[model samples]
Structures are given as C-alpha cells and as structure tokens.
Target: MAQKSEIEWTDATWNPVTGCTKIGPGCDHCYAERFAERWRGIPGHPYEQGFDLRVWPERLDQPKRWKKPRMIFVNSMSDLFHKEIPRKFIDQVFETMESAHWHVFQVLTKRSSLMRNYIRKRYSDRSVPSNIWLGVSVEDKPHASRIEHLKQINSPARFISFEPLLGPVGEIDLKDIAWAIVGGESGPQARPMAEEWVVEIRNLCERDEVEFFFKQWGGPRPKSGGRLLDGVEWNGFPWQMVPEPILERLAS
Candidate 1:
C-alpha cells in the first residue's frame, strides 16, 4: 500500500520490499534503515531482520486497490534491483505496474548495473509503461557514471534523484535524461549543502531544458532547516511522458 510521503520529491511511497544494506556514501544516515529498526520485534514486520533485504509477496497487489490516480514512489524502503531480489519477483512488480495504468510508478535504484541488465534481458520485448518512470541515485562524482548507465536502459521516462547531496556534482550531462532532483542530506547527522552546488545543477537543468526539482537545504534536522532554498520552493516534475494534450489542459 502507498503511504503519503514527507519527501517533497514524491507524492506517495509503496514498499513491496523492505530492508537494504548500505552500499555508498548516500547510505551513511539512511532514513529507511532507522525506520526499519523501529519496527524490530514486531511480528510480521516488513523489516524484522533490520537492514537485511526482504521481499513481501503478499504486497504485490497493493496498487490495484487504489481507485485514484497517483504518483507512486516504488520501493521507498528498499532497492527493487538489489542482488538479493530475484528476477522473477522483479517481473511480478512490473506486471503489477503494467496492469495498474492509472498510477505512475517512479522507481529509483542505486544498483544501476542490475537494473540495466534486467531490463535488457527480460523486458526487451515488452515496452516500458508510459506511467512508469525509472531513475538512479547519483550522490557524488564517482556515482555520476550511473547516469550514463541509466541512459543505456530503455524507459519511457528517465530521471536522477541526487538527494542526500554529499558533494558538488558540477555540470551533469542531461543528454538523454528527463529530470534531475537535487537536495542536501537530512537527519540527526545531516551534512551541510553549499548554495553554489544547488545553483550549478539548477543552471545546468535550465540550460538543457530538463525539469528540475530542488528538494531541500538539509541540516542535522531537515525540519528545522525546512525545505525552502533562496526564499522560494522548487516543486517541479519532468512530465516527459505526459501527453501534450494533457499538459495543455493542466496549464489552463
């Protein structure tokens, strides 16, 4: 089931899978890990094993029950393409997305290699659903290459979520990318984000005409810092797959 998100970047969150191991710097102060720990000892807890990845087969049909159209952030508490998750299960997730056409599924993964491989091998014949948006997390320069890897995969909409912004990611090449989301880390041990870094990405997105969403100015407590940056809030979405007619209607 989808839960309303405090994350300014997405509307709602759906976690058919939960728990994940930290793979990169972005995982330093993981909100999901902390949330999972809170559920420890509860029977049937999705993250009973703490941060050890686990899939919930019963949760697969959750999206179908929603009667309203929504923007869903898939696997908010876990990585869908983690090595522990089987290919068959990934197919089931996709099948559910395919059947539920009203909801737009946004899946972001740090496991770009697995995501690229799975899509190329299993979903080659089947077209990516127009309502499904795929993205990769690029926390720093080392991880920026994942953006290139993301380009290799065929998706109706492709984007980047550069949240927990560890360092300056100057001049991202949004050649084939549809959207770019930027934000600093937030939590009890959050890091400081330089204003110039956000400006650089914002300028780059403008230059390339890519949709830009600035999430927050993260500090030790994101709520204390608030989401405002430079006196205004950024809440943009890359509606690349949205039909022109619909966009026209929305504009009106």
Candidate 2:
C-alpha cells in the first residue's frame, strides 16, 4: 500500500521493496533507515532487515491492487537497482508496472550503471512502459555524471532528483532530460544548503525550458523552514512522452 505523502514533489509513495544501504553522502541521516530501526521490534513489519538491502517479493503486486490512476513514487524506502536485488526480481517489478497501465510509476535510483546494464541485457527489447517514469539521484558533482548515464536509456520519460542537496551541481546538461526536482536535506542533524545552490539550478532549468520542481528549504527541521522559496512553490512536471501531436492539444 502507498502512503499519502506530504512530499510536495510527488503524490504518493510505494515501497514494493524496502531497506537500502548507504552508498553516498546523501545517504547520511537516512530517513528510511531511521524508520526501519524504529519498527524493528514490530511483528510483520516490512523493514525487518533494517537497512541491509532486502526485497519483499510479496509486496510486488501492490500497484495492481490500486484501481485509480495515480502518480506513484516507486521504492521510496529502497533502491530498485540495489546490487542485492536479483535481475529476475527487477523483471517482476517491471512486470507489475507493465500490467498497471493506469498508474504512473516514478522510479529513482542511485545505481545507474547496473540499471543501464539490466535494461540493455534482460529488458532490452521491451520499451520502457509509457506509465513508468525513470529518474536518477545526483546529490553532488560526482553523481552529476549519472544524468548522462540516464540519457542513454530509451525510457519514455526521464528525470533527475537532486534532493538532500549536499553540494552545488552547477550547469547540468538537460539534453534528453524531461524534468528536474531540487530540494535540500532535512532532519535533526541536517546539513546546510546554500540559497545560491538552489537558485543556480533553478536558473539553469529555466534557460533549458525543463520543468523544475522545488521541493523544500530543508534545514535542521524541514517543518520550520518549509518548502517556500521567494514566496512561491514550484510544482512543474515534464510530460515528455505526450506525443507532439497531442502536445498542441494540451497547450490549448
């Protein structure tokens, strides 16, 4: 089942898979890990493994149960491309997405190389399902290159999530990219995010005409800072797959 998210970027969150390992600086003060540990003693809890990177095959069919159309954030508590998740399981996840055409699945991952390899080998012939939107997480300059890696895939819709914004990622090339989501880190021990950092990327998205969504002004307590930037909220979506023939119709 998906939770009604307070996250401004997306509507709901679905974790077909739960638990993930820290792979980067952004992983520090992980909300997922904290949530898992908090429920460690609870019986039948999905995050029993803490943050050790586990997959729940039983939860894979959750989306199909939802009859209404929705914008779903896939694996919010874990990474679908984690090394521990088997290739066959990845296929099963995709199988669910393929069957649930009414729901739009948004998948963001930190493992780009493995994603590229898996799609190229096992899932090559199959087109990235129209209802599925693929995205990569790039919290700093080093991970910025993952954007290029995402570009190589023939996904119907592609985007980037720059949340837990650790450092400035200046001037990203939004060539084939459809959307850009930016936000700062938030928690008790949250790191500081410079205003200039947010503005720079926002400006870049404007210049490129890419739909930019500003998530929050994260600080020691995100609730205190709130998500407002200059007295406004950015809630844009890059609908890249809507055929050119229908684009004009949508514009009117």
Candidate 3:
C-alpha cells in the first residue's frame, strides 16, 4: 500500500493483494508485471518472488490507518478477483473497504465474470457500498463482454478502463456505466491503437453521459505522445457517483 501514487486519476494505491498472472491481450505488456519482475531475486523487496499471485493480509487495514480521505486504487498491482484468490480472502478485502469507509476504493480487474460473481454473492442481500467502485480493463472488442459483466453488478459507480486499447470496440451501449478511461499501449513493444477507434468510444460516451478520460496517446513511454484527443485533453471524472460524505470531505 502507498500513501501516494503517480497515476493521474487516483490519490493513492492499496495493494492488499500483490502480483498477478497475465490473462488477456491487455495484459500482454503489463506495466505492473514489468515493475514487479524488476525486483525479483532482490531479497527483502516486496516483490522478491516476482509477478506471482500473493495476498498481503497484513496490508488489508492500510486504508483505515490513514486519517484523511483519498481516492485509493485497490489492488493496483494485482487482480483482486483472479481465479486463484479464495472467496474468503476476497471477503477480507471487502471487509476492509467497508470499514475504511472514509476513502473511495477503486477496484479494477480483467477477470469480469469472477468479479461479477463475487460481488453478486457478497452484496446479494444489500446494495453495493458507494465508496467502493468496481471496474474492468479491456484491450479490444473481444473483451467488451467485460463491460456487460460490469453492468450486471449492483453498484452505480461502475467504470471501464480501455487502456492499451488495441482495436475498436465497435457498437456498444454504455447506458449504466458511470465512467470510461481509454488509452493506447505504452512501453517498448506497445501496440498501435487507431484514432477512429478512440473517437468512436468517445462519441459513445458522449451519447450515454458516461465520463470519458483519455489517459494518453501512448508510445514507447506512457507520455511519449502526450494526452491530447482532437487537440484537447479529455479529463472527465465521475464525481457525481462519489458518495455525498466523501464529496463533502473532498470539498472541505
């Protein structure tokens, strides 16, 4: 867990679970995996074992320990709903988010069905907590089903990250989704993403009233192409979905 993060959208990162396996085209050049693997064999480092799925139960309470409120990206280093993560452990993560109600928790994952199922069972008897946001990461059209799975969830604070968007997502209905973040792949072997593809998604977001955030026009480095979309930066954020209490905290 970190008190601060460089990610433009969030204030901090909480990795109660660290490390993950690649599961989709979006994971092909995972920045998280690249970062974690770099510390492998360095004894005493948090990632000494590399990008292998490992849960840090001790870090579950990190959010609660912080007195001030912030936007916390949950499991930024791993997918919380990875098939190997036990339901009980997922329960622990949920419990922590509920307890640390002061902070907004952003949980993004590529394992859509698993995330949908877990949230279904956990919040079956009640509504999803407003402070906890659930989202999915998709690289192209094939994984668009992840967006559908997210729609099936109980939360109003649902979002999608089309980072490393490799191709057009085609026709999609973003009726209930609160936000969408789109960006091209970065790093040495980054794949190319078409402008028409991005504009299509942006137009869809415009029609559906979903907040659209264009992260970057990624190249060899994340900022290599800068973050301009049609000569303007799209920095949309879903503040309306943020709970009133937290909104008040941020306002103060």
Candidate 4:
C-alpha cells in the first residue's frame, strides 16, 4: 500500500492488512486482486502469496510512525472485517487507530453486518471515535441493505461508496448519512454506468443534504470518461464531522 494516494477523496492509504475474497458482484473485477496476483510466486514480494488473506503484524504500528496528520484509508487493499481475520489482530488494528488520534481513519467494508456487530461490541458503553469514520461499499439495489446496517452503528462520521455502481440503487433513505461517493467501475472489463444512475443518487444526496462526490465515469481506465455530471464536477466531502484538531493540522 502507499502512504500517499491518488484516491481523489483521501490523502493516503494505510493497509496494515492485505488480501480479500470475492463476496459479491462488486468483487468481480477487484483491482487489488488483479495487481496482487500478478506478483504471485515471486520471491519476497509483499503479495507473493497473491490475494490469499494475509495479515501483517509488523505493519500494525505504521500509522504511529507518521508524525504528520493524514486522512488514512484503512485497508484499501482488503476488507478489515473479513471472517478469516482473527479478532485479536483486528483488535490490534483498532488499538493503533485509537492511540493515533491525530489522524482520521476511514474504515470501509463490504461485510456490513460483521462490521456493525463488531463496532457495537467494541464500544458498547461509549461512541465510536469521531476521527474514525465508518462506511460500506454498495454496488446495486440488492446490496442497499448494507446502508441500513451501516446506519445502525453509533458513529457520526458515516459514509457510503456507490462505486462501480452496477445498477440503480432505487429509492433509499439517506438520513443519518454524512457523505456519499458515486463512481463507475474501471478496468479492462469495466462495465458501463448509466448517466441516469448517477443523477438519481445525486438528487437524493441533495434532498437529504448529504455531501456527495462524483469520482469518475469508468471505462478501460479510471479517468477514461472523466468525472463530469451535467457539466460540473461534484467534489462534496463531510467536513463537519472532522475533529477540529485534525482540521487545524490540515490547515497548517
């Protein structure tokens, strides 16, 4: 993983754990899997075993080494709540996040139920730290239930990734959601995303006053079709939930 990232929304990526399995249609053309597998069997490569669900305890303390504050995308290459991962290892990850309060940790997962259940048990008596944002990946209408699972969490900094949006999400509530990111899929086998699909979610984000960001219109490449929706770039982000200390660091 890279300390600096090109992801339009986030400043950096921190992958203390890497590798994942395909759990849904969204995982069909995972860029991470493709990249990791290419280097499989090559001696000494980080992904030498390919995308086979591996954890790096040595990397657990990575975030603490970065003295400057950053928007760290936790596990950009894998799903943190993957059932294969041990609870003790996951606890270590959380401990680092809690200790490194200066940075904002964006934790996302396709395993919504697992994530919700874990969060509830971990912080049962208190609230999820504001600096640690929680979100889910939604690709189509059927998976919209993940949104409800995400809503059950007590975190205020909640968001959704309607990326590689395979189909329209239909009518769904955006209440309690702080941010929403919409984008088309990118890869050699990239699927076409209808303009109407983007508009439908954008309209809802407007209605609910949720910060909305249009990442890109995918093709063979991520920026192939550009990120314009009705002749404008939608770069909405939820700054209200950002802890003032982090904001102050960012401003400096």
Candidate 5:
C-alpha cells in the first residue's frame, strides 16, 4: 500500500528510494531529513541509517499494486535524480511509473540538469507518459535556472515548486509550465516569507495563465499564519492535464 501524505498538492507518497544530502539553501530545514534522523541508530527502522542516501529495490513495484487511482508524489523521502542512486535503479522507478498508467506520478527534484538528461536518455524513442509530471524545486531567484532545465524536457506535463520561498524570484518565464506551488518555510528557525514575494509569484503565474496554488504562510507550523493569500485561498491545480481515464476514475 502507498503511504498517504499530508502534503496538500498530492494525495499520497511513494518512496522506492530513501535519504538524501542537502544540496542548497532550500534544504536547510528539510522535513524529510529531520524525520529520518530521529530514527537513526534504531534497530530495524526504515531510516536506521539516518538521512544518508539508501536505495530500496524491493519497493520499486509498490505503485503497481495500488488499484485506486490517486496522485502519487514520487520519492517524497528523497530525490530520485540524486547522483549516488544507480541509473539502473532509476530506470526501474521510471518503468514502474510508466507501467502504472492508472496513477498520476509527480516527480520533483532539485537536481534539475540530471533529471533533464536522464529523462532525455530514457524516453529518447518515446514521449513521456502524460500520467507523469516532471518538476524542479525553485527556492529563489538564483535557482530559477532550474526552470530552464525543466522547460528543456520534452514532456508537456511540467510544473514548479517554490516552497520555502526564501527570496523574490525576481522574474520568471512560466511558459509551457502547467502548475506552480508557492509556500513559506515551516519549522524551527524557519526563515520568514514576505507577502510581497508571494504576490509577485502569484502575479507571474496569473500572467502566464498557469494554475497557481498558495500552499501556506510559513511560521512555527505549516498553518501557523493560515493559507489565506490576500484574504482568499488559491487551490489551483492542473485538472486538465490529468489523463482522461484516470481523471474519470478519480472524479467518480
């Protein structure tokens, strides 16, 4: 069975691979790393080794077993495109998503270039399945380059996550991008996210005709400040992008 997730955008979490190292500022207060390290040194725990990059080949086919149609956040516990993960293992993960057309798979990675290259190599002869949505983590303006890498991908199901929005993402080109999720950092020592920054990205999405979702106003907790952005909730999602068969089943 798939582990249900509290994440607002997606319905469930699937981690065929676990653990990762921080690569940038957005990872400073990583929730996944925090959760995993708590169980470190525990005997027989899933994250017994803490957040040190581990591959679980046995869990590769778990998604194929879920009968109900639902949104699956691929590798919520780690980045699938992390350099250490074997290419063969990555291939297995993709194959499972490809085979399980009944479910929508959301694959987000901070390793933007690696993801772009891998996707190109894997789907060289065929187009990526519509059920699979590829995206990159854009935490601030400097990392906006990742969006370019994401755009270079051949698939049309592209999205961006600006969670932990640390600074203004100056200006971005959201063309061809179907959805955007923006939220502030939530945890101890969490950096503050200004309302102007949220409005800036929201305005950009509006200009690009993209679905914009304001996840929350970060504080000690995810809901500390409330999800209201300028007095209204933005729950925009790319509903039209969902494949017809699965969309029909989910709607029923």
Candidate 6:
C-alpha cells in the first residue's frame, strides 16, 4: 500500500530509498531526517537505523500495486539521486515509474547536476515520461543555479521547491518551468520567511506563466503562521502537465 502524505501538493509518498545526508542549507533542519531519527533504536521500526542511507528493493513496486490513480511524491524521505545510491537501483526506480504510467510521480532532488546527467543519459533517444515530473530544491540565491540545470532537462513538467526559504532568491528566471512551491522553514528552530521574498517569486511565476503555490509561512509547526499571502492562499498546480488519463481520473 502507498503511504498517504500530509503534503498539500501530493496525495501520497513512495520511498524505495530512505535516509539522506544533507547537501545544503535547505537540508539543515530536514523534517524527514528528524522524523526518521526518532525511531533510531526501536526494534522492528522502519527507521531503526535512524536516517542512515538504505535502499529497499521490496518497496520498489509499491506504486504499481496501488490501482487507484493518484499523485505520488517520489522518495519523500530521501533524494533518489543521492551520490551513494547505486546506479542499478536508480534504474529500477525509473523502470517502476515508467511502467506505472497511471500515476504522476513527483521526483525532487537537491543534486541537480546528477539528476540532469542521469535524465540525459536515460532518455537520450526520447523524451522523459510525462508522468515523471522532475524538480530541484533551491534554498537561496546561490542555489538558484539549480533552476538552470532543471531548465536544461527536456520535460515540460519541471518544477521547483523553495521551501525553508533561508534567504532571498534575488531576480531569477522561471522560463519553461511548470510549477513552483515556496514556503518558510518549519521545526523547532524554524527560520523566519520574509513577505517580500515570497512576493518576488510569485510575481516572477506570474510573469513567466508558471504555476505558483505558497505552501506555508512556516513556524513552530507547518500551520503556525497560516499560509495566507496578502490575505489569500495560493494553491497553484500544473494541471496541463498531468497525463490525460490521470487527469480524467483525478477529476472524477
């Protein structure tokens, strides 16, 4: 069975791989890491190893088994393109996604270059499957370059996550992007997010005709500050990128 998710954008989570090492500031107070570590030493717990990188071949076909069509967040607990994961395992993951064409798979990663390279090599002779949406996480202005990497990919379903928005992401282009989700960091030590910073990105998304979603104004908890931006909630989604069959089912 698929693990239901609380994330606003997706319906469920699929983690064939679990646990990850931080790669940037966005990962500093990772919610996944914190959640996994809590079960570190509990016998028979899924996270007994406590955020240590591990691959579960058994979980590879979870999506295929779920007959109902739904949006699945791929590897919510870990980055599928993390350096330590074997290329063979990554291949298996992609194979499952490609075969499970009934669902939309949201694959996000901080290793932008790796994801770009892998996608290029895997789909060199064809386009990426529309069901597989690729994205990169950018925490600040410096990491905005990841967007450039994402733009190079050949998929029309590309998106970005600016969650844990640590600092302003200055002027950046969102051309050819399908969607963007922005939010402040949450947790015990959540950092504050500025209104101007979010407005800047929302304006950019509008200018580029990209979908904009304001996830939260995060604080001690995800809902502490409420998600209203200028007295409204932004729940933009790229429906055009979803496959026709999936779209029909979702709408039904």
| Candidate 6, poorest ten consecutive residues by summed lDDT | 1-10
Candidate 3 worst ten-residue window by lDDT: 1-10
Please provide TM-scores, in order, for all candidate models, with all chains considered together: 0.92, 0.91, 0.98, 0.99, 0.98, 0.99
lDDT of 2 by residue, 46-67 (tens): 6556666777777888888877
Model 5, 1-252: lDDT tens digits are 259889999999999888999999999999889889999999998989999899988888898888999899999999999999999999999899999999999999999999999999988998789999999999999999999999989998999999889999997899899999999999887899999999999999999999999999989989998899889999999998999999899989
TM-score (C-alpha, index-matched) for candidate 5: 0.98
For all predictions, the C-alpha RMSD in Å is 2.4, 3.1, 0.9, 0.7, 0.9, 0.8
Candidate 4 colliding pairs: none
Q: How many backbone collisions does model 6 have? A: 0
Question: Which ranges of candidate 4 are over 4 A from the true structure?
Answer: none
Candidate 6 on 83-140: residue-level lDDT in tens? Answer: 9999999999999999999999999999999999999999999999999999999999
Least lDDT summed over 10 consecutive residues: which range in candidate 5? Answer: 1-10
lDDT of 4 by residue, 91-201 (tens): 999999999999999999999999999999999999999999999999999999999999999989999999889999999999999999999999999999999999999
In candidate 5, which residue pairs get closer than 3 Å at backbone N, Cα or C atoms, i.e. clash? none
Give me the runs in candidate 6 sitting further than 4 Å from their true place: none
Model 3, residue 43: C-alpha shift (Å): 0.9
lDDT against true structure, model 6 = 0.95
Q: Give the runs in model 3 whose Cα sits over 4 Å from its true position.
A: none
Q: If candidate 1 were superposed on the true structure by all CA atoms, what would the RMSD be?
A: 2.4
Model 3: per-residue Cα lDDT over 195-223, one tens digit each = 99999999999999999999998999999
